[model samples]
Target: MTLLACVALISAAISFSSIAEPLTSAQQNQVRELIRDTLVNNPQILEEAVNAWEQRSTEQAGARLGKIIEQNKDALFNNAASPRIGAKNAKLTLVSFTDYNCPYCKQFDPRLEQIVKKYPDVAIVLKLLPFRGETSQSSAQYALTLWQQQPDRFLALHQRLMSKKGNHTKGSIVSALKSTGNDNLSIDKKTLDEVRSSLRLADLLGVQGTPATLIGDQMIPGAVSYDVLEQVVKAQLARTSS
Candidate 1:
């Protein structure tokens, strides 16, 4: 039952109790019958109540997450260790937690590229979360190390990796690295630490899987459509500009 409907029923019972002594079995049955009759005659009440509850719940969750994001702004948006793309001095920034082995993240890569192209003033910080397995971990470490050592070639390699059809193996990662002229790269201890930091940050932000994107205070989970991403970017731009 919806909270509103439950509240209404509880209030009716409370009123009945207050009007006299504790209700007998017969009076309790009467209250139950009354509620059933009301529901039967006005089923729309249930739907309306459910809709209201859902809206309120969504707003509450958003507000709670907004506060959390506000508290961790630096770690999320300005971490120097995180590799960034798009405008260097962007008016708005998006923090993306992604896994190379995740098919969804692969699906999201093209749309992300489009966003970068379409919105020159927006930046995206990439945090590689190796949630899938050892191959995922190795890939993330390689990407991070590459970004640190050779920033200019990182995007090309990233696009190559994300564009791959299935789970990345050691051979595939090396092949992609070679294709992007980053074949000599090696993962270091610092890169592994950065990968761990990314995982911890994802845990802090309640990320359950790949492709969790943070735009402003909202965290969009999974691979959203280009239109949805564009709409959010526009909305955030408007809000920040104002």
Candidate 2:
């Protein structure tokens, strides 16, 4: 127990002892009042009380956070505040935050294609998560600028970054961009700075892994399977219909 709590307990114990030792009735009342006041105002007593409450309710509290996540639903997926793709007002939107150097992300790309083709109403939004920092950030910056310069070439550039073996070197990225018929991807000083700003925002979204999809509030991390993804989409679609 904390020192303050120990002191309070000892004070109460002495008061009880006084009661048993034939203290006057008035003195007993005064001792009880003293104990009451200490409990009411003591910081240690308050901390212990709070800890007890949390110990009982922590599991329920976690479950409630889960429910809040579920109910908010669409607001989480349609986070327009972050980078997005596909139809701006799509009925079914799948938001993915990914890092180029993550191999699992490449595996996820094909699954996304299946989802999009299966559901035309569904739109895919891609957000950059160049999370490895420094070199990763630089690679992501180059990729984003290229997307801005030529969005049509984004899919090809994405493939190169995902497929390239070894550490994601600037040389590899430049080579991939060149191979995609965008030989003049000269990231000028101003463009590099702009991409850096956007990348920072992606990092703040708690993006740790690639191929992470945010279907409504339910965020599925890693390379989730098509069947698993399809189940979530169906449930979300059901909510919309209702």
Clashing residue pairs found in predicted model 1: none
Top-scoring candidate (TM-score):
1
Cα shift from native, residue 226, model 2 (Å): 1.6
Q: Estimate each model's TM-score.
A: 0.92, 0.60
lDDT for 141 (candidate 2): 64
Candidate 1 stretches greater than 4 Å from native: 1-12, 15-20
Candidate 2 per-residue lDDT, tens place, 1-242, comes to: 45466567767767787777766789769767866777666657767877878977866655654575465444445443334455556677776777777778778877876787787667777666666666567667666767666776777777777777646876777788788887777654455554454355334444456777767545677898889988988887777768
In model 2, residue pairs whose N, Cα or C atoms come closer than 3 Å (at least 3 residues apart or on different chains), thus clashing, are: none
For model 2, the local distance difference test gives 0.67
Count of clashes in candidate 2 = 0
Pick out the ten consecutive residues of candidate 1 with the lowest summed lDDT: 1-10
- Alpha-carbon lDDT, every model: 0.88, 0.67
Q: What is candidate 1's CA lDDT for residue 46?
A: 85
Candidate 1 lDDT, tens digit per residue, 41-67?
Answer: 878878888898899999998898888
